[model samples]
Target chain A: MEDTGTRSFVERLLQLDRRWIFLGIALAVVVPFLVPGFKMRSGVVSPRTQSIYDTINGLPAQSVVMFAFDYGPASIPEMQPMAVALCKHAMSRDLRVIGVAIHPQGPLLGGQALREAAEEYGKQDGVDYVNLGYKPGGAAAIKGIGTNIYKVFPTDLSGRNSATLAVMQGVRTYDNIDFIVALSSTPAPFSWIAFAHEAYGAKMGVGVTAVMATDFYPYLQTDQIVGLINGLKGAAEYEDLIRHPSYGMLGMSAQSVAHLWIILTVIIGNIAFFMWRARTRG
Target chain B: MEPGEAVATGMYYLSGPVIGTGVAVLLTLAIYSFLYADNPVYKFAEHLFVGVSAAYGVAITYHMAVLPLIIDPLFRPQNTPSGQPQYWVIIPALLGLMMFSRFFRRYDWMSRWPIAFMMGIGAGLAIPATVQTSLLPHLYSTMQPLAPMAEGRLDLLTGIDNLLLLVGVVCVLIYFYFSLEHKGVFGVASRVGIWFLMIAFGAGFGNTVMARISLLIGRVQFLRFDVPEIFFPPSP
Candidate 1:
């Protein structure tokens, strides 16, 4: 009977090797990058990335901005694009940037972003930017920085006295910072909101991984954070807002393709399941 | 090599693109072999990653934290203007040293003091801030205009959104209210709350999927574009 044939087909579909799906995903991602003249159009700008852009754009030239690269190598794929976009935007505005990290790999990643931006803008390291580097202790160190940065970060990443850096001449604590942006993969942003933002009344912005994005929505509504950029979509939106198409924008096309593939797989799976159920009922 | 570059002249070869890209590609492929089956290649890559991260973490902790926070400050002349030592840092220094007592079976109880002190301070610091920033503000935001008036006039779309949000919040809260029995209208409302919860969870899952795919795309791009450009630069 047709019912038996249909049931067998559905069963086979259900039992298909998962490796095939993995291969599908691989193709979905790789084809976009390898294709000649493949240009990915920028995605629609979300309000979060827009807010981040507006906040940075509205800042005065030479304003001191603090960027906390609170992430590691594992998070580089997601967080790095946002960092690059932020550094580029801040540097373009002639803003003086002070970079720090609570996580060990943060300083290295932060330094990479600053160096890339600085080179593009022909900006001097000591004068235009300084990387204070990784300080141990999570929330406590954040509180310490807000209170007395000199005591917390005695020296910069390269062992130069932090006080000697031209960028750090008058900038001491959170009060001196115009804006504090925490680019994080963990709960460090919430710690910033709790310790630094609450105590010092520091204007905070956050760029968190997508998985952690929705949990911070309440803070955004409450105006506890001025701006938020979540995941690669946020990074792409930021790059689009800044009118510079970079890595984030470039990756969007492949992301779209992969999403479509996943959605299709889900739809097929549901249909097969329902078909199998109908056959059993008969 | 440039004189002012971060890499030392003797170790310049270590920073070359070939070694970096080769290692990256090999490790990525090895990890991706898990899609086929669990094998020694994947396990080797996994163990290597764990080992390197642990080693790096220890080195960074000592260099960044212990050197500056404890060793340098206590030894540096400027920290103690007079010949006498600055005893202020000694309190924290002693507490930090106590944390290492966990290594010895007999002395493990001593480590509890530092752990307790840290937790106590952390709780004391976080509670007030959480209440002010997270709790109160969240409650305030959730209590938005139920009718969603725009410019002293009623707007249909805004009103619908506000009404849905209000209903969702109320229903969800009601569902969690243990005092109320699941009977009559309460049961219906709780059922509706389940739908709203499902929708929120679905949204979160969608976002999670998007994030994962983004990561996959990044790795593929690295293999395709990043490594090629680094190892085999196009002629000018």
Candidate 2:
């Protein structure tokens, strides 16, 4: 009779200490950042990131744009730069920006972006941009904006009423609001498009984590959403689109090396599997 | 620094003898300890992540939901024409409040409306967007020719890609549709569909691993580059 167990080598391979795998993954990442030599030439810009640029770029000077800071600190590395770049670009164009957050911390993050960008572009706080901070309603807040933008966001980051400002006067609803850019780690962007865009035909933009991109592609294809900045890759793509370089590129180069490591590991694992299989079969 | 700002970031920089190495090594070991067996250290970190995230979520909801709706319209109203209440919204708002009462067990059913609304709306938003964003565009994108497109003419490469995508997608769709039995052409089609699914999964896995590795790189950059001030100051 043929030996049935055959040392159950594949099982042992399967049972191989997972700690080693974790360590390998850790090193696979850690080594790349410590040293330098990796570089990235701008690959072809995906249409997704470009449309966002074009949409923001195309708007007239002092166009009123509302952007959300929806992610937390963990997501800052991937998301904050896109928010900053877009804020900087918009402020540079003299776009009147309204910073809001579905996330509570959004006011802080969004305020910081507007302030930094304002300083860089020499924009006045109330004149160039306004940080609406965090609002009360979830999706309902978005729907409310269809009727009254001021009612939804009555105050700035501070307690001051929005009606007191020049920026808030003509902006009644989503109709007057030139563009809606939502930066979310969660599902906020989709809701904004659904509630506000569907209800009021607000021009919509979304920047989200990459894993969510596959889900958003249908919206992109339908032309319901004008642009997408997905994951860090999408952020990197956006950085390329802006002609300003930052962390996205560093992340990309590290990512490229790590990818190559995994590919090699897979190849080696496959070879070992095939060899073990053939010996047992013989 | 502001009152809310966290300066420590859990990092304690010190001179000589790998002072942080104790914690760094312990944390690394603790995180990795989950693989060998589940223990207190692993549990601690996991709980810490969950607790911090939950606190953030609760705080956000307080501002984003409670303060704005129940607190604002009821007590503190701003930006009103006459400083009066938008009292009509209180009905649905009350219904929304009934949701948190689920923890009381007896009042659990009240939460159904809010939960159902969330689910129903999420599904509602997702379904239409899915068709508009994912299904149609992917169908169009995949139809491109494997080679190149002719200028001012029908893009040949697109057409070829379209053919492959069409065949693959249709077969994959058929695999899910249990209206008919798997037989003859259907069996073959479903098998071919598996191949397309496998290829897609492989690519997804590759990209996903790359993404995860990048996240790990960020953590490492913090450890080696950010923490070690004795060796290096901030890169400027």
Candidate 3:
């Protein structure tokens, strides 16, 4: 009778409503914030993230570093933190930052990051940094920038002449750029690697969403990109390196709890499946 | 100053950010309602999001690409550095306009010209660069010396990693080779390849989960902290 009861319980678990899982996820995410003095240590920085920090840190003051914003609002949570962190790091290092975008929504998102970081650092517009903004073609536009930046971005995002901007002063092409970092939720990094890195030998790195991170390992290993920042954990690692904890660090506790919830569910679901299968076979 | 009056004054000062935050919170909650069950609220939010995104795309394209690249260059020649019309802009603009021909059945074939031009140019530019950046470098990295020497002596760990990588790559490649039958030694290699592929897939899936959880955490943070903060500013 006990054996039959145990079997039925497992079967019931197997048939558990998915809404329960959703509620569990919500609780897991919420409880961390509610708990008093709860904080998860932003763990040891990964070498891949370290490589990005080191690359930026190693650059000389006033070196031109271009950031390609190639993501949309859907990716704001994952992509924006990296952009802000990177922008802050670059500005702190006194590097001349130039922003560009291949995605339509990238300009606005990139501009927001730049504005936030600039405000923190008290950096001036046009003189310290400039937003070249979005262009239509992806790989082709990147190639055009490699040839003549003035021709591709004749005017800045605000309709100011590119030639008149202080940041654009000697930045004619990839030859002038010290480094390029493409923050993307799309395959824009590959386009940069092809046109900017391979074609013109522009040194580059990439910050990508976690799902796309695995796809770029081969490139990272081959030194096609100087470094790779993989999603939010990567953003946290970067925040730690820069000694300024923001959204990335704040989200770690909730992220950990939610992940634990997922793992627990997966284990239970698997156990229930196996038990049900054995019962059916018997 | 009275406390209620101070609160009212603060709200007036922060009206813009507060109203924006309220709308964001509503939309977020409406979207999350789908978790309970697909309802009108969720459907309304979803449709609103889609419509807004489409409109934003069109507006951005015009401001970023059309106005500056085509209209300004051709019409307002004074805006150009040379202070003369860029005739070259007309060619690309005409090609871009040809894209709209697909909307009309009779002239739909004209769309092929721009498509072919783009494909031809893209392939011509990408093939050589892809080979140099992706294919060759990957091959070179894979062809590492198994017994790598660091300083003077052989690095055992490095050698082991290189060997494992080599074996994994070879096995995976063999698994994709379908000309021969899966029997004898080939079958064993293919099975090993399957294990490697599964491990890769597992890692990819884990990363994907992490990405989704991070997004959820972001929204949750906004609701938990940002919303309240917008209404009640912390004293300096």
Candidate of highest TM-score: 3
Q: Model 2 over residues B1-99: C-alpha lDDT tens digits?
A: 331232233122343334655465456557757866899999987777789779987987776566765676767665343366668768778778888
- What is the Å distance of residue A92 in model 2 from its true position? 2.6
Candidate number that wins on TM-score, 1 or 3: 3
For every model in order, what is the iRMS?
2.5, 3.9, 1.3
Q: Which rank order by TM-score, best down to worst?
A: 3, 1, 2
Docking class of 3: medium
How high is each candidate's TM-score? 0.93, 0.80, 0.95
Model 2 chain A scores worst on lDDT over the 10 consecutive residues at A1-10
Total backbone clashes of model 3? 0
Instruction: TM-score winner between 1 and 2, please give it.
Output: 1
Per-residue lDDT tens digits for candidate 3, residues A33-73, read 89987887767889899999999999999999999999998
Per-residue CA lDDT of model 1 for A82-158, tens digit only, reads: 99999999999999999999988899899999999999999888899999999878888899988789878877888
Give the Cα lDDT of each candidate: 0.86, 0.73, 0.90
> Which of the numbered candidates is closest to the native, going by highest DockQ?
3
TM-score of candidate 2 relative to the true fold: 0.80
The TM-score of candidate 2's chain A against the true chain A comes to 0.89
